[model samples]
Target: MPHRRCSLWLVSALIVPLAAGCDDSAGHDPADDLPADAAAADRGSDVSPADAAAADSGRDGWIDGDGPDASGDPPAADAGTSSSDEDGGVDAGPTLDCGARTECAGRCVDLATDGAHCGACEAACDASEVCLEGACTAGPVEAWTVDFDFGGGESALVEDFAVDAEGNLYVVGTGRAAPYRTLPGSRAGGFVERWDTDGTLGFRQVMPHLEATGASPLGVAAGEAGRYYVIGSTVGAYPFDATHASAPEDRGYVAAYDAHHAIEWLITTDLVASRQLERHGDRLYAVMRGQEANAFPIELEGVRFTTDDGIGFDWFTIALTTAGAVRWGHGSDTDDRANGLAVLADHVVRAGYHTIATGGGLSSHRYQLDALDHDGTTLDGYDDFGVPGGSAVAEGGGVVYVAANGPDGWVLQRYIDRTLDWERALGEAVHVSDVVVDARGRAYLGGTLSGAHSFDGEHLGEEHDGWVAAFDAEGGLRWVDIVDNPAGSLWVVMKEVEVSLASGLVYYRYRVTSRDGERVVALRQPE
Candidate 1:
């Protein structure tokens, strides 16, 4: 964990010299000695001097004052002002007494209430927030929340979600029984729903279980002009198209839906499960996995990949036009699991973990990041001693961000031009669920934390909590918000996170575990 020096201007006035244990080498400004009212006002409440001092006691490198200055003697009350110079000559002029105001950028401003300079100079609050008690307070407001009912013996497990350019949200998941308002007789099936920006349910399409084995939609990606794609697996015949029926064996599928929720085209293969889908330009990329023997002559359109002996499971990546025309297909021979897919302007990146035979029938798991050219050729590859989790690519394909379970803990890495730029260890026992990068190259990660963990300089206690964090382009920790578990809930898990480019709001889906099973909640955090 990296230690960040506490900003000097934010410290209280009653502290002794060494008690400000942080690096004090920076020149001290007169604004450091703010009046007691400013301290109380910053907290939005009245407090005694001792109480104000105690408020920062738990902060890193902050301690109670007990001794004098370096000269072994206490300084005068008005230490910021001196009548004479250090050489004992006449002073330049008398100092100004702004009374209750701090001098910031050559102006007397109330630090406690100034939104542009809250707590310290230039510490501005967000547009939707106000400065209170010297701190930026308010939202990241929850714009809205919507809940779904599984009805009867059915339960919902959100597989993936996406937000289109028009701010409409699309969610895809699996339900054990029929969803609310839907016709009954379905045992287990997959569902897709669209919600308007204002939380109105635009449309809900439920694909019921037609066979003994169920149907599950694992991934979704929004395309241009009000179109979207979903990739998943079905154990029986094709559910969307009757003329395209298949065998009882598991089959992977990719279905395209138009603006009016009408199926434009549907494609299927013997590839078992397609776990992730990504859209770039007019093309769609999907990653699928299946046992070699189960999918011997795996075929998608005219593209094909064959295996011998059908020993272990293999993963494949297929590129196709939005009209369901397969462009190319690439497959891995080893035992690997695909976790995520990110499409850039010129290429696509696949993130997952690969198992290697370490002799004596033992194996080792290594994180794998492979960059494939737009034409489905391997352009570059990276592998390390970890388990790859999720990945996101910045705009223009110039940078990439990946999250993995490293040897020591959870780690987030930044890659530029297919090269490792930097890696940051999140903390011990942090389970990262998803990662997404905005247009400005900022990365947002959501997950759950257990035990004690330090994110940048912020410390979380032993209790479990869900967290959403933002980092800059250079991998610097910007800020983290913890979603505490509610009462009567055992724990919380963040399943997915998506950043709406049109609205700049971050939407995250979380599940709360209680005595009655798990409940799903979706919240959009305002910027």
Candidate 2:
């Protein structure tokens, strides 16, 4: 793979540089690319100051001076081990012991680049795999070859999708008639469908209450026990309503269904706008944005919303037990809108934007990322000013990445020590829809870019296409690709993108206009 290095020119967009050696080439082992003179330098002689400085700077793109022992001085030598010091004396950092042999997959193998035990214990590789940058891979995994079109007339649109642990796919959106019988009050509106791994439809259930309420499915989240939840806003009155609907009231709703698309429970809340749903542990987390709560003590089973003190748009987060008991609820005190939610480690991270006044009542919105403990106590938080869209967070390898549309373009921020480590941006201004970080520290971002755009140093022709980009751990661009119509007449707009950590594949849904009607298509890409 060719290294896609970032330009150092600092423009309006805060473009950052990616290290040259960070790219992973097909079948290329990183250990084999080490400088030939490294062994001689390790002999404790002929070491130059510049060479030490280069190592300290992390020119190789791995460990940097951010480590505790990287203080620009020769580290204290461990017992029975020595290396050349700054003054040509014997001193060095701690030595690495691979024991009698490198351990991998519960067995001892080689250390100088054995594929099974490349550099550390249990770092086993597949058959015929090579150790590149200390990572093992057989090769590029096959991406999905899926094509689906529903409601072929003028009504099809996909909003979101999710993959369960068993690799089953769940897609939710608004469309035509349901392919199967649905729950009572089901109408010709939003629908939820399940598919096998090979793109075969298992069942499609028309999500009800949308026809009368004029609501559509916004997001879908699959639970641990083979259950799934769909959240959206509806105008119709439900079984739990306190008052029958005289007119359309935008009330938020969350419904749980079994693997066979049978409704288990349905919940409706006074909070009018629902954004998304996420499941963590045994609790279901739902986020919504609603206007000032005029009605105090609006109650749902085990949950309540009160805004007796203020009148403005509010974002609320509610946590519920598997059986639908609200465990806790949190809400913002400002005019904030909830964008997304994720459960990372022992904390729940909520991302969105809140507005701040500039002067004379004019205001601009800034993105905020808040981390809350399991019990809903606020912990560390970050505020990104001036970005139009709120930042979205994804966790991988204990690192959290936040992506947003900055003043100039799409920006990705990395936080280390709960503080900003690096901020990177793409050159062109594009509407970023979603972002996902992988276990290997790579970030995959999807959105639509109009006209011509550049990724790293590579340029593409002018076209309106849904674009997906990959960035290495060091914030270097790996590759950029586009999804467009072969005829080049239709505009492909990405609606949502989801990544499967287990399969290391990206699944995205987009929309394009055809002669028959509007078509919503889903495609997959290899990680």
Candidate 3:
């Protein structure tokens, strides 16, 4: 959701086998189902993107582009198809021709905007109303879309959106429309909007200091209660490489909002514009592009919000540029730097890829994940799984699910505690960036396929479009679904998935990384 300078990590306290960090011998468990790659292949292709879209669309009730947790018994298909379904073998729902019928939840309806399913399916809202999270109540999809009026080819562009537990939807992006209104040619009228689930528009306020018309909110995570966090960069804040200015003034922003759609707190950091935001309880976590300051973070500080306001929150700093371990600070990266963190109930898992060696300059190594305290205390005995793509840590069924995307997907392992007892790889290396787990102990991953797509026009489509493979509880290979019929990046790249326990909706979002085209899909899977 935002970008920043880099550098952070602590490989180990003491050195043993020292593969990377953590105690590999303690909790490593062999993949339960099929190997990552083979698991994808072995599963037959009985399901399609339609099946996944319908039955297992969301675990909770409503689904957005943020989470992915769905379960259903689907008819058998190509073994490769099983690789894509997270629940493995079973009939999830009835397969429908996506192009013909607009799929929402699990039922197929007419696409000609109805009173039930507005955009697709039996999903029709009132006359002028659009569908938000199924139900066909009232109002538009998001606050941002209703507030801004573009007046160009399209009214506006909705880059990112997130919904809270109160059934209120929050969206931030560029443009100006009614309800989602922006000042006339105000140039920098960048804004964030929040809408109630009943289709009532809440707040539509504008943010100051955005560079141009390009800066838009990318990733978003809802916090405890109705709090919201957004991340994205300004078009030309400081302008690093000449053409704009001398010093890197182009900075990114991570802001917090209260339930009533008000800025509770915010800060500007010089992170490269990226779309990735994750909330660890009350605090928000992101992989921003900031300047590589000192070796570690001075402290884990944020804002103080009593009621839609910041009450003198401390201004702390950390220089986590590379890949090293830290107690209360950031670290340095090897070649380039990158770090990913996710929150579990009791622990916050921080992981890094292509980690370099520290000190007297030892040989360099790649890939490792570490669990740390919410206050920045590195947990003990980590190191059982080897990941390539970014990693995601989640808790369901009383077990913690740590899914990391790697080159193809050879390096992957699950854990119950610090000791990793099982570890295994699919060996194909498809590069699954993140993973999500359900209450029934199922894993769903999303990312791009390396050689899977080719760039044409502004869209990225593949011969088959990036595939989503499903793995069994023990890491057995399940089914894999080839998304999208046209093969464009439209439905291929699953940037994120939101799984809500109460709502039972699994929202999966995908779009062209090139920032072209508009595609929004919502489906409900039958329990």
Which candidate achieves the best lDDT against the true structure?
Answer: 1
lDDT of each: 0.54, 0.49, 0.38
All candidates' TM-scores?
0.68, 0.64, 0.51
Please say which candidate is ahead in TM-score: 2 or 3: 2
Candidate 2 C-alpha lDDT tens digits along 1-527 = 01112211100000001111121100001112222211111011100111112122221111111111211222111111101111322232343233554434434445433444556655665543434434553322222323233213333445557777645567665543322222344434555655444333434444323223344565788776668888765554432212222133546777776654445676666565454687765778877655555444445575565432434356666777667777666666433243457666677777767677799979877777766776777776554433666456666665677787766776888765456778887655565677766667677677776666666445452456666676778897765556654353465555555655553345555545432222222222223
Ranking of predictions according to lDDT: 1, 2, 3
Candidate 1 vs candidate 2: the lDDT winner is: 1
Clashing pairs in 1: 42-133, 42-134, 43-133, 154-177
Instruction: Compose the digit string of candidate 1's lDDT tens values, residues 311-427.
Output: 336677778888889987777643334356778777888775666789999977666766688887787544432463433333322567788775577788877767777888887
Which pairs, if any, clash in model 2? Answer: 213-235
- Tell me the spans in candidate 2 whose CA falls farther than 4 Å from its real position: 1-152, 180-187, 208-215, 238-250, 296-299, 302-309, 333-338, 358-361, 383-390, 439-441, 459-461, 485-491, 513-527
Candidate 3 clashes: the total is: 150
| Model 2: how far residue 365 lies from native, Å | 2.4
Question: Which residues of candidate 1, in runs, are more than 4 Å off?
Answer: 1-137, 149-154, 176-185, 211-214, 239-247, 294-297, 306-312, 333-338, 381-397, 454-462, 486-490, 515-527
For candidate 3, lDDT tens digit of each residue in 244-325? Answer: 2212343455556555443455445444434445554444555443344512222223421111112112111121211111
